[model samples]
Target chain A: MTEEAPAPEPRPAPGLPPGPFAGPAPAAAPRQHLIVVRVRLPAHLRTLVQLEKETERGPGHGTASGPGHGTGSEVTLELDSPGTQSSLLDALETRYPVLIGTIRDPRTRVRRPFIRFFACEEDLSHEPPDSDLPAPVLAGTEPFVILGAMAGG
Target chain B: MSTIRVLVGTRKGAFILNADASRKSWEVNGPFFGGWEIYHVNASPVDPSRLYASQSNGWFGQLVQRSDDGGTTWQPVGNQFPYAGVPGTHQWYDGTPHPWEFARVWHLEPSLSDPDTVYAGVEDAALFRSSDAGTTWEEVSGLRRHDSGSSWQPGAGGMCLHTIVLDPVDPERIYTAISAAGVFRSDDAGTTWKPVNRGLSSESIPAPEAEVGHCVHRIAMHPSRPDVLFMQKHWDVMRTDDCGESWREVSGDLPSDFGFTIDVHAHEPETIYVVPIKSDSEHYPPDGRLRVYRSRTGGDEWEALSDGLPQRDCYVNVLRDAMAVDSLDPCGIYFGTTGGQVYASANAGDSWAPIVRDLPAVLSVEVQTLP
Candidate 1:
């Protein structure tokens, strides 16, 4: 039996979009760095997450971190490189699983109706989930804030 | 001597009212989980110190809190409640198909024997159980998957499975009530369910005498006589002596019979209580007088108990889960109102007093009798 020659590797034509059968593009440098982002949760969520941490740490470890301890606390989340809103939230929910359906819909991953996301003094509530956060938020200079909409009352 | 602990859930948080056997003076402790709506706070019959609170918010969703040291300290447990399989559609307010979704837990019924095994009645009308002390939850899907589920619709309130009464005599028997869907019984420990709504009629629905589709607000049963059940519907007070096999209207002397809560006296199986609202359109008491009607002969007769309750100019509504009774002698009856008053009747509804009158809108009140 004659062996058929392997099909030549498909290449995209110049000035044309890659076709369905085009070969995989050359590998880019691996972006496997970890980025630590800070998240500031509203009072309700801060109390919840804080209570969970205290429980895990056992009694007396964090008893002083009560609801009136402060306005909010920064939760450091380690996310993969090029972290976006979705990535940051995925990490946040993983770290604080109790927050799964609080900030966003568990099934749809859509932000809850009365929950807003903010960073760098701008409203990012309507931004796409995969959109890159502001420079300050990504650089760890400013925390990504989750606020309960004032209108919910 | 015994103590009565009234677990009060409200629009803003959970409060625990403690009083000695006299049931007079009280000490209120809470606002726990402040800013969150506490729908129900229940203690396990097997372990009075173990309690469960259903906390939720419009913005943050639901959280189940467990307290091992009674109501002294609480820790968040598993809040994940995934419906079993593909939750099919139920009728919406506009008579359109609405997919099933998990809103907030409306009630928590801890197991009569096992502290770890607890059942949750939730909005969007479904039942869930946690076998590991609130660490995990699994849907008891058979009830929601009933043959008549598709036709179920929400009442003025969202479609919520808000009442759960475990048959103390039969460990395998369970009873759950849903808004606008009547009552259901699970004989095989929640593995399967059947609508026990026969003899129930609702004028609002197309077929008044249909097997289901009745807005049953609350159901109560004296543990000693589980076969006899008392129900407060959207418009009538009903009773069933054959385990919901048949029901008869007992709303005879109640002023309006359009109330949200009905409960049984803890010691007297024949004594029952109901708060009659003016009408469906107007949810307050009749003639602006807040009254709790007590029927000593089970039904067809009731007497208004309004000594300590507001007699006029009161416009707050009592929710379905807001009334409960303690097992103490003379049976202390407790209920909370939307006007932020938690009223307690020390002498079985002969008179009443407010345990606390300035809390948030009261959603539910549960009582635990401790030795």
Candidate 2:
């Protein structure tokens, strides 16, 4: 999974935009956005999401809520060229309809109970539930992983 | 080589901090599974060889872990679940121990009367006792039946029974502090329960009794004097002499009174220790000047004991269950931080030394001194 370290990109502060803000959404696409999924998924739910191998469609088309909606059995991840927390999670959910209560807060963007977010080599636990993730991670060129934080002792 | 064994419990898994007596340093290995947020880790006193860990796992509910050879290898007491009626789940919650209602075991204390007798504090909020180590459990009917249920309210961490204080000498006389709940006593071995909170405050608008919402964060009684007590409360640090009949603030002398966890000397009943965790600020430990404060003559005076610590901005929150004192002669005081740091104090609370750093965020810290 090594690809020359993505050209020494500048790491932006978490929840903040990269470079100067031009407007609501940046025009430039993230140069290094790539999605990698790790799963210990249960068998029963596996059949509900119709499994698909690698199919690179544009943005949210691959998310849990995408146009292909109920067709895919795999969890999908998307980075809006350069990404935002809102877009990343939304993209994944758009494609995987069964992932309703898996990630974000069921009622809010806050992380769900027993669910935690880690990136930029730090636990982004203190960040506001709705804020954008660090820009470097949005680009997704680096490794982005989403897994369950199982309970019990 | 003779070594010092350290048991660390976490919301996701448990880790073992091991090292030689030389204290040259240590090693950490874990993420031990069984589901359940492990809030308490006790290295057995009778058998330094065995370790006990309790947590909210699933319908297999409460979890119990034992390390036979000083924490190197671990075995989960899975079958003991239905016996205690605790919940156990294999899935992750908030990426932490799955918190089950009918049973969420938060505290585990080994009985001094019978080494096999172990205690588990659950969420439906009952104290279940296991006589054959963690192999089997029974709800201590006396204390469990008398619980004041109507008053119990769910805290952000969930309303539960926390600190269980066992009399090292008299097992029959035990005390447990309930969160948002009050302090309870079982003098006749949980056969009967009564509020030990005299001076402790309650949420009662008309007349506050130790009924509920007085929420005790931790209850520390002098190891030698069961009558004398000290508590790091939900909002303050307090002390009492007549067995919780009344209390007084012993925390006005610090930066801020909002913190978790407190300790005392294994030898001297008068010597005490408390970590100054930031209550009103974003940072846990004020500016990283996280010195462990000690009060030799009660909580009358507090001297900063962070001589060898970092002088930079360090906001580390030390949990109520993360600080302790080993049974060494000069009395060694030890603690770890949310920032993944562990420090040691050889001379009680005088100065400090960093034993290890850059470990995972420390959830619980337990040390065993080998004879």
Candidate 3:
């Protein structure tokens, strides 16, 4: 028996969209009104976010003068409003769930042994959870840095 | 086709290795909680997809993670392990009274029937149970309040309740072993407890024949025969056929019996395994050979299996809770070493191979046989 010739490949109809050939459109960034809050994580804690990077700046910081832009060692967190230390942490944990208990206790909500907090070059680690952050930090001009204290000789 | 998942908890993180029934060509995945000490990882018996992991560090203290989708994603649940009421004191390492304290969990025993129910054995030698799927833990204070608790002292390790074995035959009965406090059994579903160290003796204690104060490293039991139990004590391999009523030395023909982990074959109730370290102080294998001694007749008679294992320059120690068995056709045996090797024996310990050569000093291993 004579072998049948292979059928010719079909092309998309003129009026129809490119169904299988079209790749998905780039995901539109979330449109919530975001507040930029800079954060600095310790070297050890850096391993937690080793695989993922929050390189995308939210709508709030379209300008290059965003908080932590000049500081080479800071990461920015997006929040709905100017937040306190705990609120900033809430935003951070929401973004990176793995860091839930690394910076604070899962139960007591106490700061971990070697984890310290700094804002405007002042130690704000022991401040009350609801206390308003420094004006520069609140204005997204200075990063709220998470410092891993010097441990072990 | 059968699938086997070997869950390994190490000093630095956790790893999961999967393979088919042929026991060849494995796939390894892990370091789930990287940079943290993963003391134990166990899956729910009723629902294999659900898992509980004990994650802790010196800096962060302790946290419990739950993964409903096997281990792809994990969520932090409640980490509060509060004593029921009026937390009392137990004897410290210095033989002085010390207040009770909450420490990291050493073992998590999921219920045999309910995926939401679990038991956590923690340091300071206390037992806590969670009926809400590990969301919150309530101490089964009867164990900490047992009369002998005050006399219980910490071993070189802290006074940690590291072994928890639930009786499949009786829902009300539970068994837990502590580092230096011996074994305690509760017949009232953790409402109350009593020490079960009747035939156990240790020269390290003042009263070697006393009710408590035996460093019980690990205990195992075949689900089919819940009344029969096997234990690896500080310096002896023990077996108790009548539950914990009495025990006898089964350390017979092994090179050394001062080992940390002991487990029973999943399919054969009479087959058992132990890695005999030189001694309690010297935690290496005898003669620098890593040999796993298996006793087909339950105990006493033993044979060393080292086909694919290191027979020289092997100085790694296997910690308690570091060995487990899978319920496959020939019965698969798996264990991890302090030197970071996870060995697997698919044919009842007749031969062996390492599923992973370098993990972070494995602390625990558990196997789940999937359909």
Candidate 4:
């Protein structure tokens, strides 16, 4: 959970450093901790997002023994800074704008009735929006899962 | 070769039925955008290949879909319809002031000369237009911000602007109708409007001869004779020859005057069609028979065309926008029913046959004549 500043550019040798005209130290570009997280979307959301699957596997088709118990065609998403559920959703919607109101209400920001959120084999549905994601999910060892609940027979 | 396309909007999705000028056998295409309510689907008059659909659901809100190659493919368009300035209040169902809220689009009207320009009539009673081919929408605030708007009230179906009619002769004139609010006409291209319910009398309203609050269900006008309008009210069929300045009851001799849909023949300006329901409370036809009455002499006399329609134990309601007419030589007449049946008459109501029997209850039907 510690922030990692980006490595500073190698300083030019004494004579190579562009003399007195060198510009003010470029404000160490705000260290944006980019994290790549795997996302497992439900069947309905996968269709709504309309992302072409890289593999032939369908929803819940992957290994179920890992920290992320269920599997599907996983999409890798890149996020910056603290990767909370809210931030992750913001990033997902930014990439797939058509899903603005599909998984969450546009006005209320509440999850849809038949949708569930999970990670590390635990239901993160009720977790606070700003809470940090699970360690396994943050480390890319597990996927942030979006599952459609089994409602009717 | 000339072709005819019938766009049907149902409770679940939209279906496009295409056939040649012969109007004999149709090739059914789809239940496109399945599982979503498609309220209206209309083709652009200038560009037959351009189409627009109003897709919505209770859970996810409203969405506008546009197709460049007719209905072959579609992509979501803008759904943000913010009212201009402060959205004031209108009368709610109980006669109390209620804040204006954005509801689903009830009708989509593409421009006559420009495919990119379109208009939308939405619930909570507002009109919006998009000049960028449905990519963005801005409300034509003049209609909703009129002086009499505060007195506007919701009908049983909610205060929805459901009908839009543009004059073919004069591009400056526009007409729109709202349930429980009667009819309104704009002379300066929707920039301003005035109530045109002068002669409309409804017993359900507080005043029978009031300027507004008549609960108009639908209105139709043949492009050739734009001034002459046909209206189907909650209990009466009306005719207005003076650009809706005044109207006269033409509910003549029919099984019942209570009905929803009304449309004019494509070639014949005087010829009109209406499906009379039993009563306001009972939406089905009388004696459990389905009939579509045609009046060739404009309104006084009528004939029930039931040759190919059901006669016994068939009780189904036809919504206000479920009827349309194609502009072919023979001129086909079409309408869909609550029982999920779409019937078409090639020879103008002389006889009819079902196109597709099982669809979610049809909400609207529109036709395009293509060459």
**By descending TM-score, how would the candidates be arranged?**
1, 4, 3, 2
Model 4 TM-score is: 0.85
TM-score of chain B of 4: 0.99
TM-score of every candidate relative to the true structure: 0.90, 0.65, 0.82, 0.85
Query: Model 1 misses residue B173 by how many Å?
Result: 0.8
Candidate 2 regions with alpha-carbon error over 4 angstroms = A1-153, B1-3, B29-31, B34-37, B55-62, B79-100, B202-211, B280-283
Candidate 4 deviant stretches above 4 angstroms: A1-32, A37-45, A52-59, A62-75, A101-153
Off by over 4 Å in 1: A1-30, A51-72
lDDT of 2 by residue, B242-348 (tens): 77777888886877666778887889997888877766345376666777777887786777777877666877778777877777667777787777777877677
Per-residue lDDT tens digits of candidate 1, residues A69-103?
32225577777767789998998888778788899
Instruction: Give the top-scoring candidate (DockQ).
Output: 1
Per-residue CA lDDT of model 3 for B97-194, tens digit only, reads: 99887768999999999999999999878998899999988888888888887888888878899999999999998999998989889999998898
Which ranges of candidate 3 are over 4 A from the true structure? A1-110, A119-139, A150-153
Rate residue B209 of model 2 by lDDT: 51
Specify the highest-lDDT model's number. Answer: 1
DockQ of each: 0.24, 0.02, 0.10, 0.09
Better of 2 and 3 by DockQ: 3
The TM-score of candidate 4's chain A against the true chain A comes to 0.67
For TM-score, candidate 1 versus 3, the one ahead is 1
